[model samples]
Target: MRPRLLLVTDLGYPAAGRTYRDEDIDLAARLRADFAVAMCHPLDAAPLMAGFDLVLVRNSGPVLHYAEQYAEFRRVALESGTRVFSQLSGRADMAGKQYLLDLTAAGYPVIPTVDRVEDVGSLPDVPEYVVKPKLGADSVGLRFVPRAELGAVTGQLIQPRVPFRYEVSFYFVDHTFQYALHAPDPGRRWDLVPYEPTAADLAFAQRFVDWNTVDHGIQRVDACRTEDGDLLLVELEDLNPFLSLDRVPPGTRDAFVAALTAALLRMLA
Candidate 1:
C-alpha cells in the first residue's frame, strides 16, 4: 500500500518576498505520483497527522504566526510518535535564533551575531545594524537601526549590516546536496538562477548540514559572499524551506524530486 502523506502548508499566507502557495502546490502535485498525498494548513496538522504515515511540513510559514497552536501541534506529534519530516528535532528554526549566536561563538563561518544590547559594540562598525527578533523569520519584525540608535532597540539581537556580494543557497535531501541557486542581484532575492557549486562551496555548506545532523528530511544552507569573496552563513533553514525548483533547469529539478522521493522512501523503511 502507498504511504499516506499529510503535507502541511499555509496556502493563504501572504509572504512579502516570495509566494508560499505556488511552491506548495507544485510540490504536492509531484509527490502525488508516489504517495497518497493530502495538503492541509499547519493548524490542521495537529488534528489530522495521526492518520497519516508521514507528515511533511513544507512552507508552513513562520510558526510565530501561531505560537500557541504550534506548541500544541509539537506536543501532540511527539506524544503520538508521528513521523515529521525535518523532524520536530530541528534545532535551527524550530528552536530559534540562539543557534546563530552559538555558532558564532563556536567559530563557525557564520555572520557574527549577538542577542544582547550591550554586545552591540562587539560587532563591526557598519553604518547600520540589522536587528530582528530571536524567533522571527521571513523578515518579520526585522529592522535596521543606525549605530547611534542601537541603545533604544531593546530586547533584540544585532548583526553588522554586511555589504554582501551575493546570496547563494544550497539545497539538501538527507545530508546530500541536490542543487544550488543564487540571487545575482542582491535587491531581488526571489529572482534565483541556477548555481553551479564548487567542491569548496559544497564543503562550506556541508559543515552546517553536518552540524544540523538530521537523519532525514530537507534543508537549505543560506549564505552570502563578503566583499573579500568569502561565504558566511546567513541562515540555516531546516524547517520548511521553499525549494526554488522553478529557477533550476528541468533536468536538475527532476533529479531533486527523484532524490527527495528516494529519501522519503528510505525514511519510511
Candidate 2:
C-alpha cells in the first residue's frame, strides 16, 4: 500500500505577496501520485496525525499564531514516534532564531544578531538596526530602529540593516541542491526569478545545510548578496520552507518534485 501522508498546511494563510493555497494545492496534486495525501491546517495536525504514516509540514503559516497547538503537535510527534518531514531534530528555524546569535558569535557570514543590550556594540555601526522577536516568523513583530535607539531595544534579536544588492534562496531536498531563486529588486521581495548560482554560492549555502541536523526533508538556504559581492546568511528554513514551485521552470519544478518523492520514500523506509 502507498504510504498515507498527512500534509500540514494553512491553505487560507494570507502570505504577503504569495498564495499559500496555490503552491500547496499544486504540491499535493503531484504528491498524490506516490502516496495517499491528505491536507490539514496546522491546528488540526496533532489530533489527526496519528492516522497517517508521515506528517509533511509545508507553509503552515507562522507557528507563532498557534504556539500552544504547534507545541502540542511537536510533543505528540516526538513522544509517539510519528515520522515528520524535516524531522523533529532540526536545529535551524524549526527551533527558533537563536541560531542567528550562535552563527553570529561563531563568525559565520550571517547578518550579525544579538538579543541583549550589552551585545549591541558587537554589531556593525549602521544607520538603522532591525529588531524582531527571536521566536517570530513571517515578519511578525519585525521593526527597524535608528542607531541611537538600538541599545534601548530589549528582549528581541537585533541586527544591522544590511545594504544588499539582492536576496537569493537555494532550495534543497535532503542536502542535495535543487534550484535557486532571487529577488532582483530589493524592494520587491516576493518577485523572484531563476538565479544561476556560482560554485562559491553553492558552497556558502551548503555550509548551513551541513550544519543543520535534518537529514531527510526539504530546506531553503536564504541569503543576501551584499554590495561588496559577499553572501551572508539570512535564514536556514528547515521547517516548512515555502518552495515557490510556480516560479520555477517546468523542468526544474519536476525535478524538485522527484527529489522530494525520493526523500519521503527514504524516510518511510
After superposition, the stretches of candidate 1 with alpha carbons farther than 4 Å from their true spots are none
> How does each model score on TM-score?
0.97, 0.99
lDDT of 2 by residue, 1-269 (tens): 88999999999999998999999999999999999999999999999999999999998999888889999999999999999998889999999999998899888999999999798888888999999998998889999999888767888999899999999999999999999999999998899999999999999999999999989888999999999999999999999888888899999999999999999999998
Candidate 2 wrongly placed segments (more than 4 Å) = none
Model 2 score (lDDT): 0.93
Model 1, clash count?
A: 0
Clashing residue pairs in candidate 1 are none
Number of the predicted model whose TM-score against the real structure is largest: 2
Top candidate by lDDT:
2
RMSD of 2: 0.7
